[model samples]
Target chain A: MYTRQNQKNLTSAQRKRFVAAVLELKRNGTYDEFVRTHDRYFVPDDEDGLRVGHMSPSFFPWHRRYLLDFERALRDLDPTVSVPYWDWTTDRSPASSLWGEDFMGGTGRGPDRKVDTGPFAHDRGNWEITVGVTEARYLTRNLGRPHKPITLPTAEELKWAIDEPAYDVSPWDSRASGSFRNKLEGWARNGAERWSNHNKVHQWIGGHMTGGTAPNDPVFWLHHAFVDLIWDRWQARHPGSGYLPAAPLDRWDRQRGRVLTRDDPMPPWNVTPAQLMSHKGIYRYEV
Target chain B: MRPYPTRCNPRTAAAVLTRRAVLRTVFTAGVVSATAAALAPVFRSRRTVAPAATPGPRPAPLFEETYRGRHISAAPAADGSRGGLDVRIDGRPLHVMRRADGSYLSGVNHFESFDSPLDLARAAVDELGSVRLAAAPAHHG
Candidate 1:
């Protein structure tokens, strides 16, 4: 079992080892495959397949399990490593040294490549990219009916089309693209409303099924993680937002028309939220 | 259920401690026949009570003006759980769950719209009295 001590207090050497393990997972296809196959990991519940557009109560527990799975994969590769969380609160400036190119792919500065230290520096507010009619049309054609698209795109397809390359008209390029800032705005202003709509359909499907139209996308987990992270940050700032007390935990039970749960055993890797709460036993992002 | 102890005299405390130790030993021996008999039925009866389901009518969104002067006044439950006030705002119902950990969770519009769970929980403690639990339906089972 991972302990809080091991994760909460990571050594410099451990950080290097942890980053290397992440890169290794990225290379060996393990990370990509897990994101693709795991129902709770990267599956979105919307027409456009936007993962963060809305989230369910199961969101936190699901990512908690996914990150733990990644951590375990890392440990299996190297026993001595531990995960670290990035406390974005402590370092609000986008130019904070933590984002250095040596860690994430971008140059450790703002999107403009200049050293920035304001709230907008790492500010995700302006990073949002709207799913306008043009992109939405392309996505609808390629993805087919939102309820049951022709086929779920591979993570490679999703990554290349949306995250990696510029938008093109190819039928293969079905998702939207834009800066992270624009997406954040879309989420803030319309996130709850959009999520409520998407969740209604998702809950109708009972929350679990692979190979459907939108849920099939592999970008789901990363997208939701960012959503979950946003909610986390929002809660930190507002401190009064949350699910209703009567917001039935029953809705969270995968057996009760929802696809995931706080305790559901994710396939090919059987783990649960009870196990992930501890910092020591699992791998986590450096928050 | 039963109020066990608020305070104990040294003599009674010592005797209680000794009794607890003795009970632990006796428990291993399976010899506390009468005590076990007294506890079993209570446990069984508790299992028979229906679990509480999520409440309803869904709370409507509370305007910032609604919470301007509210302050929590009641002490928390012994177990650290908090009690909340349910209030009707423009004919809509809201339920807030507050706990002593300085955290709360509230449901707006019965339970349809949820704010951040942790924030709602904290708000419950901060905004008591301003709200009141809606009357339980008269025909509840």
Candidate 2:
């Protein structure tokens, strides 16, 4: 099984190869397609099959499959090129090597919030934003702008999130304040702090990471790899929790009728939660 | 039913109008009252209750448009995946999404988040306010 390692752990050569592979993918137009898919999923309206991955308990599984799909695409080009995870907790500053000129790039400058440093920089001419809300085609960042700042989540907070026993509580969606899913997604508060986990990281990064087409940024892969890692950890902690909206299944979806179960078909993929939970033949995380 | 008195008292006749006239007046009064009551709700409905701002159509997906130096745009999460609302303004991105508990979420700020579309729109407007700043040359980065 292909092992996804931490971004900080990758050697210089590994980082170079990884960056090269990513740039190659961008050149081949594969990266833009991923951005297109993520942008489509982030569409705001809830009408007719809109937001199933996020806010719902399925967020974990859906992203598991999404990251896997992305990893598979990278492997298709070069088997040695594995997706890495970004530990924001360690590389807390915007000046981290991940954002250095050779890697993803640093914060946007001036009013445009356009990122000028790094390989994925807009002026680099190699990374063009073809999919997103605006027609402007350029990679952007506002790393900790004066109004908005990035706060890397702490390990204690992540530990608190994982410690929660239930997979999700009532209203098992993104808004469920106390549920692990809601807290991990960064919608609900963590008692002391208003922002937490995945959502916090996204907002903290701001710029392209916060946008609908976040996948346009190569950092999206590393960030999500960490999220997936957290999921695996949560699963290990609560092996019996299983998935939610399964069984006794009386929940009604006003729009679609019954709520989705673990056995229900996941969109954008043929597999179901039952199929994703194990991750046996698919791949493994090298945590 | 009450039996009619044999003698018609003139005083009573003077006090009460002709049966036909009385009936006409009563029916007319009843009709007017009913009509007023029936039309009451219509008038009330027409009266502006607070004049709360009506939410406009969900803003169209802004594709790579820049205002001032900030950018405003939207897009679906990913096709074939469970979808969610993803909005980006300059550096901040807002997610208007549903939760597992059936509640919706709108990313307002680092410290605050909301579930209402109106709130989401208002937050977005405020966030995009930076776009109103004086326009600079096209971002070269």
Candidate 3:
């Protein structure tokens, strides 16, 4: 078993080892593969088509497995290294420790919005964006989206989502309302604030973080780790409640071939959301 | 942001639609006719010259416009792939995909799908701010 600590609490040495492992993954081309994989699986839900990653009930499980694969890759380099979580609810500033030059680095600056400080900065020659939507080689970020003035997810906003009882509801997509999965996944269609939680944080970061190739920014793992922790907390709070859509939808149903049931196998590893229901002995979040 | 979640609200959407309809009619006549349109509104009305059919909302021009000082357009991809559209902003290619839900998403702002490719392209421009989108690599697996 391993512990995923809060990123703010990580010591300088622990941060060093984690950064080293990620840079190694980038050097060996494994990092780019993760970027490509996320871009590939970020399928949006539509009529009669399968979607396991985003916009579905499996968004949590699929990403949980994806993070496990990534953490395992990091452990291959150093057994002590575990992915840390960035609780955006608290660490909501550009000046926060999360963006310090010693670790994940600061916001992208200048006309190009390029990250020029910290280890992952482009000029350092250690990190280059190979698998990207655009030809830009540098990793970029616009923390707080200066001109837009967007804020991070608030603690109150998070409480509102975790309070939800059902794992998911009908249609099992982004538009699905009143589901814990949809709420935490952060697709708010009712008000002027369209993106609230997870999606909003992505927007707050801007640049490559806004798109499919977001993993190019090393913080992707930490951001996801925190999101994964929320699932753990949700599970503990609602032990009686479990994953919804327990059985596959009827064959005639439009969502039959599209949404993954509790037992349906998620691709890349063929593990079902049922199997990934709980982390348990595998790992635990350090709360 | 105007055409986003605010557009999702039925009440606000109606307001936007009402304003949009007026702008659509005024902008539809042509740039040269903008001044004379108010004076000769009846001549500018399509119903006066043509039939009453085709009286619904005029479709938005999907291509060739400057968005936030950035020139953006969408065209059928050269490869002829299904739902494949070659979108660009400021002369650089902006990758786009068609969702089964009939919305369009782009390389930037991939999470939030837009109602049309034009909206998707504009979102990318907004996300970029001052930084320009570089030419994407020829292939992405």
Candidate 4:
């Protein structure tokens, strides 16, 4: 299986190939379609369009399948390209080399905060946004301008989240108070500090990365890859912990008539959480 | 037929028979009138109306309207409670719910809390922006 490597660890050649393959996807219109699909789900007006991939236990599986699809698309163009994971906790600043012209690109500029340098820059004409815009057409990033000083979770904080006894707690959602998933997802906060993790990173990135179609930014892959890596780590730590709300357990069908169960097929994909619990046949992350 | 009251001739008997026929006709006419009055409303209503029209879909709100021009802020609370900070958007509580685990959840999206109100508000703005143009008529081109 192709291994997903830390973005900071990628060799110069590997980084170049990854960048080129992403450009190729954008050039072919496949990338924008992915962005559009994600946008549709997150902001669906109908009951069927609730954010199933988010605010629920399906978060991990949905994103895992989604990332796999994207990776496969990239590999189709360049067999060597694999999506890289960005350990934001290690970098923690806008000045990271990952934002240089050679890699993903730098922070955005004024007026609209659109990036002026890098492969995905509007000047390059390859990363134009085909979806999720009403007036402006370029990708944007304010990069900590619109929020507090950007910071990533510390090792201790991550350990605290991973050490929980259960994968999820009652409610099993963003509102779940005692859930490791909620804590890691950045919704569960300690005391009154507010939840701060995945959500914080997205806000820290700013611009298009903050939006539902954040995948429009190539960094979106790196960010999510790392998130998946954390989930993998959590699974390893709690070997006995399986997905919550097991089958035969009834959860009212807010979207449809059927009650939700672990075995129930996740919409927009044919897979279930049980199927995605392990990375066995799919791919592995390079530690 | 009784042959009694022979003195009572055929003329009086015929008159009595005519009176009984007139009374029967009046009673039959009254019944018909009463039945028409009772049934008139149902037929009249049916003729004038059709089955209720199915409600058209309700339109989604505009992105700008979600907050109602309210600014979101997250800052340390003055009360000095253990909660650290208060998050408010549009001058209303935003990420105010404290879970049993001590993590904060936003009432806005019921998602994770932000490190600051600014962070939380930014997420809310991004979420609101995700609304498709068809749903957000004001933003439509």
lDDT for each candidate structure: 0.32, 0.61, 0.78, 0.62
Number of clashing residue pairs in every model? 57, 44, 0, 6
RMSD of each: 21.8, 16.4, 11.5, 22.1
Model 3 pairs whose backbones collide: none
Backbone clash tally for model 4? Answer: 6
Off by over 4 Å in 1: A1-12, A37-54, A108-256, A259-287, B1-141
Tell me how candidate 2 scores on lDDT.
Answer: 0.61
lDDT of 4 by residue, B1-141 (tens): 011111123453564457546645655677665554554444333222322322554222112223434455554443322133444444444323333233343333333444433555655555433322211111101
Model 1's CAPRI class is incorrect
Chain A TM-score, cand. 1: 0.42
Give the number of colliding residue pairs in candidate 3.
0
Q: What is the lDDT of residue B69 in candidate 2?
A: 49
How close is every model to the real structure, measured as TM-score?
0.32, 0.70, 0.82, 0.68
- Report the first chain's TM-score for all candidates: 0.42, 0.92, 0.97, 0.92
Better lDDT candidate (1, 2): 2
DockQ of 1: 0.01
Q: What CAPRI class is candidate 2?
A: incorrect
Could you tell me which 10 consecutive residues in candidate 2 chain A have the lowest summed lDDT?
A: A250-259
Candidate 3's DockQ is 0.18
Candidate 2 is scored at a TM of 0.70
Candidate 2 displacement at residue A10 in angstroms: 1.1
Better of 1 and 2 by DockQ: 2
- lDDT digits (tens) for residues A1-287 of candidate 4: 87999898998999899999988888888998788766555421111223456666677778888889999999989888888998877876778888878998888766456788899888888888766432336777767644345566767678878887577655555567777777877777766656567777776766666555577788988988998999989888989887775745322223222223468787688677788888886688998
lDDT of 2 at A151: 73
lDDT of 3 by residue, B1-141 (tens): 012222223564575567657666865856454453353433223211211222345423347799888899875444423234557788888766555445776778866778877788888887887667767432333
